[model samples]
Target: MKIRDKILSGILLVLIGVLLGMILMFFRQGTFSFDLAEVKVTEVNRSESPIWTDDELEKIDDRFVFKTIAKTVTPSVVYIETLINARDRREMSPGEEEDGGNFWDRYLPRTRTVGSGVIITADGYILTNNHVIESAVRDGINVTLDDKRTFDARVVGRDPSTDLAVLKIDAENLQNAVIGNSDRLEVGEWVLAIGNPFRLRSTVTAGIVSALSREVQIIDDLRRIESFIQTDAAINRGNSGGALVNTSGELIGINTAIATQTGSYQGYGFAVPSNLALKIARDIIEFGEVKRGLLGVTIESVTASTARRAGLNEISGVLIIDTVEDGAAAKAGVQSSDIILKVNGVAVSESNQLQEKVAMFRPDDQVTLTIWRDREELETDVVLEEMQPIVQETQTIPENNFDEEQLGPEPEMWEEIPGDENSGIEQQSFRELGFSIRALATPEDPDRFNLYLHRVQRGSEAWNRGLREGGEITEINGNRVHTLDEVEKEITDSLKNHRSLTFKIRTGQGTDGYYQLF
Candidate 1:
């Protein structure tokens, strides 16, 4: 009886061990399936079909335009939240690199910022501002749709010059914005700014287009393109990258910035026009980059002084200051001081406007430029060139390295310019003029030693008139100056006559402008 009892006990113990092993295996397999399962969200659907026919949209009552536009656009504009980890600078200790860091670091504090985005396609391609998700960490972007569904977002591409970025989510059949022609937007037209303002989602504000092609100088990049549509819409924080729709429920712009003094709306808002935004978005989606075409010339707005100097009858068009060697404009016979009256027959009065027009095209695309030179209008066909990336030119003297003699005049002082044998540079400071002058040592040779403005005092009359440092003094009072003495004599003569000094300055950026200083 004792041996039989021992055998039964051993069988029972083995059965209990087998039961425990099965339970453990079941739980492990359940956890793996729950955590590692793939979701069906990877397909991208790109179509050119319109969401709603014009006739179908036109059937709506005129009185319901605002409400219809709001309802249709709200679903396309999404709320974007980004998490930027604050522990980016935290160093991992010994034996911590295997799992990335200490376990506690995973729960470290994060900085969160909110913005908005517009769905440009049905497959979940989104367009927003670069500043919105510029520094977001890996897998840290969460997008909340109008229907309250959330998904992780991935960056498609970014264009800092345009302040634009593209993102993608694992979504399909999403409501997309109906893009309209922004070039046809007129001043005083009714428009709506729709976005999440101050964390308030789906906020809409009504306003009229106050201006067009406004260069507010808000973009921080040197290669920035600013031809914003200015409106009196109430755009505040968190409204960035939102949609600015027209009465026809069409997307006209992307709400970008507000001209405010108290951190709220003060009757001014700006947006990137839809035509440009759409082009940028498509480029990013197709090529993973912004392929901007270049005119290969430095241009400036044609002011009254410049118009008069260029012998123009009216203050209109953009002035070509200088042309790059072998550039599109140069190859097309576009000369310095020529006024660009129109591009493809569209009048461009500001540099930003011209930039926007050219930016709409790709490299090798030909454009017609109506130029005003010698008081006559002439048209030339220019093939747009690829924009060259900004490169730091290697020179014997660094840009900021200064010498004592290169400093400016009596009341105001400027940073210096270092001399080098390779440049054959010489400088002279004119205290009476509030600036210093520099030139090549071979002053007698016009080609070798063109006079350059080494320094100009801050707040000086010349500086205020746009006579900046590193400017080549090509001409003074309509006469070309090859030597420093000639430049001084012309200035003295102008001052003696009590006349405003007219200077033709060619800036380091290769833009030429005429400035009048008294």
Candidate 2:
């Protein structure tokens, strides 16, 4: 029996040795028919996606390959040339219009500014920075393609909220930058900054997306709309309105601003999120204006300090400060003290987050605002409001109270004339601060104020609203503006919206003081 057991054990050892030998043969002899030789035939059919080109693939192996990538992506990028007629002082006295200090400078272009833009559409809709058309006072804006050809550009519309402007050049078959999804962008993702930095066309710089939704100062407006994709790319003056593209040359952002005290290229740069810029540009092209939704709530970021003060268990989310009276917030029951946790289930951390969310809506569209109130979370429906037309109030001579101390030159022919009897009516309180007006005494009670209709200049905000010579603003608004100071304060306070001043007025004595919301 012992001999029989030994024989079986020996057979088992022999079987194990044979299995080991088979395994080694399988690995050494192109096992499973998937060796490198077979892999090549499979790849030839698909081009191995992305790295299909030898140069692109070789760079990936090198770990320091941005040149080949940039060269391939640079052509689709565009260079924007802006013919800015920036209204600036040239050390000239009262009556001298020194147009760029030369004969051609006067009649020809005064300020020729060249920047960059990404041609988003093939048919000539160029995406650029609002500051690229910076002045909003351009005599004409021109576009020069990657090709040397130049085309006259038209400002379709500008969204100062995003610092994006869409220009239309009458050219077809134009190369548009590839568009990318910003939602897919992550911190430390590779991105390329391509533009005419300091007027150098088609210059490309490489960097990574250092951050997202970083609030930086792009302008001086009280509203801090600096929710930008931060990158370490070398962005400079002429780079404004250029393209911040991905490795594939897809447009992801419109490079708009930089953080340099010397006004030159700094390590950091900002870009208008292309997703937002495109949304606004499309609207401007189709409807002549950006239709961003209004939530009517003033929001602030919940910092650690604010989070503790506000009793927030977590130190993130947006705090609702002031809900405009009778506006969307008021209607939505969003009170001043409530903290906003999210919008439509998306967490909001700052005003820019809320603003960006709201901007996504169209007028009349409803949105759900998630808020924490009294230690309880609640969701409220808010109806988005249309952005009322806001025309900038320009500087005008105040007929009523001219600030003689602050006066510049008044069209030289104008010296102090003997006070005309009619001048008493022009001496209203608000006249000297860049607005024109007249005053009248109420006939019913010689002491009471009356509607004084006068012809305003063509470019005045009142004129833009179609104010006529015979129109009488009867009231100063909800308040009485018989004095010019009252009128000025009310207008200045509500400069952001379309609050018209009403005058209790009629064409004749039967009328009363009327108002006009300028």
TM, every model: 0.67, 0.61
* Candidate models: Cα lDDT each: 0.82, 0.67
**lDDT at 324, model 1:** 70
List residue ranges in candidate 1 displaced over 4 A. 1-64, 87-108, 309-311, 392-518
Worst 10 residues of 2 by lDDT: 392-401
Error of 1 at 260 (Å): 1.3
Q: Which portions of model 2 miss their true places by more than 4 Å?
A: 1-72, 89-109, 136-139, 220-224, 391-518
Give the Cα-based TM-score of candidate 2 against the true structure: 0.61
Q: Write down the RMSD of candidate 1 (Cα, Å).
A: 20.6
Candidate number with greatest TM-score: 1
Q: After TM-score superposition, what is the CA distance of residue 486 in candidate 2 from its true location, in Å?
A: 30
> Weakest 10 consecutive residues, lDDT, candidate 1?
392-401
